[model samples]
Target: MAKIYDFNYKYGEQKVVLPPGKYLLECWGAAGGGGCKITDTNLRSKGGYSKGELTLKKETALYIYTGEKGSNYAPTFNGGGKAMMHEGLSNGETLYCNGGGATDIRLIGGSWDNEQGLLSRIIVAGGGGRNNFETKGGDGGGDAGGDGSKADSKGTQTNGGKGQVGLDGSFGKGGSAVSPSSRENYGGGGGGWYGGGSGYNAGGGSGYVLTENSYKPAGYIPTKEYWLENTSMTVGGGIAEENGKAKITLLQGLPFLVISSYTSEQAVFTAGHTEENKLSKIEWFIDDVLKEAFTTDLYLEKTINYTLEDNALHTLKIVVTDINNMTYEKVVTISKSIMPLPTNANLQDISTKLTEIGEGFKNGKTSIINILALKNIDSSLNNTLVELSEKIKALFDSGDASIENLMNQLIQANNTITQLNSKYKYATGTTEVQKFSGKANMYGGKYGNTFDRNINDWIKIDNLGFVPNIFYAEHENVTVNSVFYKCVVFAICNIPIFSNEQDFTIDTSFSKEKLDNVDFRAAGIVCTNNERDVYINQNGVCIPASNNYFNLHYRWHAIKFI
Candidate 1:
């Protein structure tokens, strides 16, 4: 059975630590409140609805926030705006109403009520705008927010705009009505990725979806007809009611185990799974006897020791189980044999065989032993040449012609092994590359800063499982001395991605772009690439820049050959 997490109307953001797996996220926003003294509640605008798929690389935290229904007295909870009121007017006599709050799901570093958290919002459902005495509030949904009936203005991707007479809105916060000399009051705007515009009647908020691979629902109001086509569900489909709600469903796959290698002494194995957290346990067995058990870990290693004088076939097996109680197993067989100690009788038998060989040579009977007869021995044995040398020495001491043939065969075998080893060292065609991407925050130091660089001026990324040879990095929207600047940084290390570096070249090129009052202009400036400063380390990659007294946030993507 799939795991489900449901959330209702909440005042603040809640935390959910999801296991490593794929999931489906569904959200619904709240509806706006009607104007003061207006009993016809059906005129209130409906909130937006959003549903999509989300994937987690590991166990991650997801911040969930549900919207609150708008009321005439106070501001709506969770990013809603407050209704405007004149100094001399009361609530019952006012013509204003508050906007509804939005429901959203935020990824890493997402915080409620913070504009900086907008960068982490992956899915959002916009709230409806408030209603006024003359016109109705706008309905929330679509790529952009809907305009109010009388406002004639809407919310955009960045920020909200003002209508004929209202205050402008910012990210995640709705717009409010403007103050005037008259006694009249206007409605408030809705909350969303970008809040709606404020006017006589407010505009609805805009919905947003940011996912690598996802399916967007067809209609603004989710229906059973479209839910069946969009997701794996055939039932339970609808929009949010007065308050907002959210649901998360986890997707699971079958668990598997692969035995990488096994010997009479030790065994090594790895589990096959994309979602590492889904695996529950691993059991190791030798000769059908359980040896060790591991919990919630994929890698398995065990050591087996044979008993005294034991010469028999041994068995090694491993079983893996998932959270769903599904199991998979693999088995391998190995042999354990020991040679017996030489005794007096064995020595006498060896002496007799040597004497017989000498007598046969004297009788003029030439016993031509074929070199191919030795092929029955294990070819994988590394000591094959040493054993063959001992046999050739015995035959040569007896002056046999077969010794010359054996010596020639050993030379040919050694040449074949040398050729195979050379090909294996340089063999290459196509290989998959492992990818890693993340954001790093750095502070600038003095120019040409090498050893005296501040600790915060650079970032060292390690435990990446493998070192990166190629890097694509860029710092955007960096505010330096009250000016927003963007720069692109690209680097390549010429060496094996997974191997230790002896002598490597690091070529780093950076391009700067300046934005003065939104008029973007590109300026090409080549930064010197110093190998002593920026080079691939045995642990991972270290990235640094030569910016003086600047604080910047950069995103980087690294790829290494698998």
Candidate 2:
């Protein structure tokens, strides 16, 4: 036994520089103190990795150095607080976490058993993409799933052993026809080192976390009138832990800023692959042709990054370009999901995906001075188009068809921008609209419409064939002098699946939590256009539009197609 840091430790349990004397270090496995071994010179076990520090010395009577952690439990890896080694370290002493984190982890004189914990960082590799529509699930990615490391074992990966990240979707054309329950038959993303993949074919996975102290901010977080989609963030370890075969090896220090909820309407596109002098460099291919080659650095964070239309599904392929330009192509597909429309949309919506607006305007074309959100009319955008169109009446009543055409253009632009922006916020710009250079329309791929996996953004409709915006026939116009032909109105209604069910769970202090389910519907209105008036009594039919949310009613007029 030796007196190190004034604490008595068993032989071989820790190593030290000697007076050239023969001494052995003992084992301090789980059998040791429940976690960090504690010598029971007085009886009973104590000491834990939670907040324990170690100090070591040599037999020369002169202090060789502080004892680096020797695979002890309390000081497992990221738990080493202060007084850590940074440069020269003893056989069992180490400083500076390899992955870049609070200097934690130390070397044990014993063997390589705990080497995985000795490193400062860890990386959980991605799992292979899942297969839907007749495709075998792609093999879990190398190191991507973080299985190369050992700590990710089941028996070993306990305490949620830091799961692997799900892989990106594959671009390989998933078989036609949405596979059973899949929204899109796109290949699923592979599991990465930290997250679990979505169970359903095209689902996403839950992310994992490993940190110095813990991942969450201490205490209760209050919810407010927030539009933020998600706000949780976490740091990760680098060592990919392995069990007998090394399960999720957490490489140790991976960068932290990249953790995101990815909730923006527009999502950026990114591609990544492991680096090194392997079979050559990895490369990317859009459809078939090569785009980029991979390198050893490819394994590092942020290999590829670009903003893409949110709610749009995209397919990309990656291949390793050898020094000879030989290719090892791998497919990666990225798809974005639409955020539920906000009752009152505003700036500062929190999302994991970064979104960008087109070069034009915040609310779309300048022609549309009014916003659909302002019009209170998703219910009205697709309606017959012109029941109570106040703006339409203003247009044609002037006896100028040109003005009527312009008004129709404005409505079309507003509706189109709303739906399109809601789907692909990145495809358009948020810059304010200051002027209108005349009438404009949108076509092909513009306004983010496409059948192929490649989703397109808004295109300005200018030339005879090109209009940045398109008109809704139901929103057709009948200027003052123009005739109003009676047409049946098929309007949409907004309903509350459940009226606010206010549940009050009271203690000494009363607290009320109200849960509301908002429901929207399209109900056919057989009334003639002439009978379309705000007063329900004048119409042959009437339906309740009450869910009681701020009066529970939809505004804006339904219209008739030209």
Best by TM-score: 1
Candidate 2 TM-score to native = 0.17
Rate residue 336 of model 1 by lDDT: 43
For candidate 2, the per-residue lDDT at 367 reads 20
Query: Which regions of candidate 1 fall more than 4 Å away from where they truly are?
Result: 36-40, 72-75, 86-96, 109-111, 150-152, 158-161, 212-241, 253-562
Estimate the TM-score of every prediction: 0.44, 0.17
lDDT of 1 by residue, 1-562 (tens): 7789999988888789875556788877777655554456556666777777765534567789887866765778766667766556655463437777878887533447765455557677777777776456775654566678655445555567465367666677678777565576666777776677766678877766663233333222321221211422111121323887789888655566655554446556777554547678888776567877788435544333434224343445678788787677765544343121123333233334333333333443233222222223334432453354456445644775563454464555455455443333211121112222322322122233323222234434555444555655555554345555555555555544333423322223232334334555554322222344444545665555333334444566666543
Q: Per-residue lDDT for 168-283 in model 2, tens only?
A: 22111011111233222222222222221211121111121233332222231211211112112111111111100111111111111121222222222222212223244555
**Candidate that would win on lDDT:** 1
lDDT of 2 at 208: 18
**RMSD of every prediction:** 23.8, 27.8
